[model samples]
Target: MTSRKEHALKRRDLAVNKLTSLGDRIIDDVAKQTVPAIRVPSRGTSNIVYDEDRRYYVLGDRYGQRSLGNVKQIKKIGQMVYMANFCKGLVQTGKTATLREMYYVSEGWDIDFGDQQESNIVGEDLEVTLGITREDLGLMPEEDGASVYGDITLKDDDVEINAMRMGKSGYTISPTIDEVELLDHNVERVIAVETMGMFHRMVQENAYKKFNTLIVGLKGQAARATRRFLKRVNEELGLPVYICNDGDPWGFHIAMVIISGSAKLAHVNHELATPNAKFLGVTASDIVNYDLPTDPLKDIDVLRLKELYKDPRYRDEFWKVEIKKMLKIGKKAEQQSFSKYGLEYVVDTYIPEKLDAL
Candidate 1:
């Protein structure tokens, strides 16, 4: 296995090579005295396609171009080039920046971004063009938003830390997960729960010990860091990844995002998606079968379910069947609904049944 330092160096070199390739093409285009145009895969909704084989969303054929000749797009082209240089600098110098910092840092650039969103688009444009994730380019999110608790041991650089030792809050998952290595672990599975309350209960009850699994708290929609960690757990540790969330569209989409990748982030799906991850429970069918306490489906919930019903990722027979059931019942269930049985039911009966089903 390659050492983390060596791996980081190789990755940085490759990123710089890609950035240099883009630079060379633009320089050559300029020398020819013709308009320099760079074409990236269109990030529009219509241009996002689900790859059935890979089981993830990917960029489609439709192209969005930034050309020097197009006055409206030239400013963005300048930002793209500058952003490419920024990424190259980051990788070369062994430094990092947040997207917000990247936006503010542009104060020094001639082709400065108008706002963080504009700067973010430039960074995303680089991602689509280079086929590299923002983390690989040394740009990280403002905060690491997920936590983990379990028997798994991880090596963050050279220091080894036992996840279970962390209190109820658990270990904060790192967005730049490539830098961390999984150490020897006794965990059999990884269970990622969507709610903070449930995560706390699991942690407090020593659920990891009960199931011999690592339980990660997603703090709602799983952040990039949490998803990356889950993918690593799935691929590297060969542990099954299962998500337990509500029986609504939002919860369903969260599981789908972890499993198949979201359309908005198609470019980095390979790095973040876990195609084999399973939705543990709280399915529309589970809502009926478990007879868990439920709340009436809101208008927004119905709309989202309808949209997901048409989404290719949710086209599986199980998804189709469950979504129809939920719509028919006009009710949604939450993970907290399991509390109706008792505080221990989720960890004891409910979880085991779902695990056995898998």
Candidate 2:
């Protein structure tokens, strides 16, 4: 196995090689009096394929689009060059920068991005073009979207974290998960929650102890670090993972991101997605079975459901039935709705029932 330091060096070398090759190509194109073209993964579900064997979504080799002689193409080339140089600097200095910092850096360099969103598009393109993550470019996200609680220990460099021993609330999962090593854990499974309210409820109720499981809060969408940590736990510890989210479209998408990976992060999907993770609750049938409270589906929720209903990645029979049922019911359920039975119902009744069914 390669050491982390060695891996970082290799990644840096690869980035440098790519930059050198790109520069060579541009010179060659100029010499030949031809257009300089670059290829990037298409930024949508269309170019993303579901790998049944891997149980995750991956970017396909389909030719998305070619940047040639258009003004947009010229602008993209400039952005890519700038990003490559930025990454090179980070590698040379052995430093890291946040996504916000990168955006500000671009602004400081007088990159003509209208807003942060535009800057992010260029960053995504760079990831696809380089076949690496923004993190590999030494850019971190601002939000740390996960928290952990269980009989687990993490060793990050010289610092050690015993999650279960970290007071009553447990440890906040670090954003720099790639730099951390999972030293030890003695848990049967990991239960990942999508909402903070339910996560707090589970922690307050000692759900991890009751079920002999590890609890992680996604806070909504799982961050790259959070997903990477989940992947490591599942692969290294050999623990079955379960995702708990609302029955709404957004919650379902969150689960999908964990289980199958997202198109935007296809470059690092293998390192991030927990392919064996199962959906534990808030299924459409739970609406009928548990007699949970329901909120009327919003316009956006309905639109998103319709989109997922037709998505190729969501073609499973079970998912199809679930979405159909949701459409028919015209309502969505939250994880918190399980509280209707009792505050302890989720930690005691709902979780145990779902675990037994697994």
TM-score, per-candidate, Cα-based: 0.95, 0.87
Number of clashes found in candidate 2: 0
Stretches off by above 4 angstroms in model 2 are 1-37, 44-46, 64-72, 110-112
> What lDDT score goes with residue 90 in model 2?
83
Local accuracy of candidate 1 as per-residue lDDT tens digits, 145-221: 57888887888767888887877687899766777778778988988889889999888777898888888889888
Best candidate, lDDT: 1
Model 2 over residues 1-358: C-alpha lDDT tens digits? 6654566578767766776676687778879998877777676767777778887777888755555688757776887778778877886776788877887888777556777787788878877877777776777788875888889988876788898898766778766677676778888989999877888898899998898889898888888888888888898779988999999999988998888897766667887888788888698888978988999899998899999998766888989999999988898999999888889998888888888887
lDDT of each: 0.87, 0.81
Q: RMSD of each candidate?
A: 1.7, 2.9
Q: Give me the candidate number with maximum TM-score.
A: 1
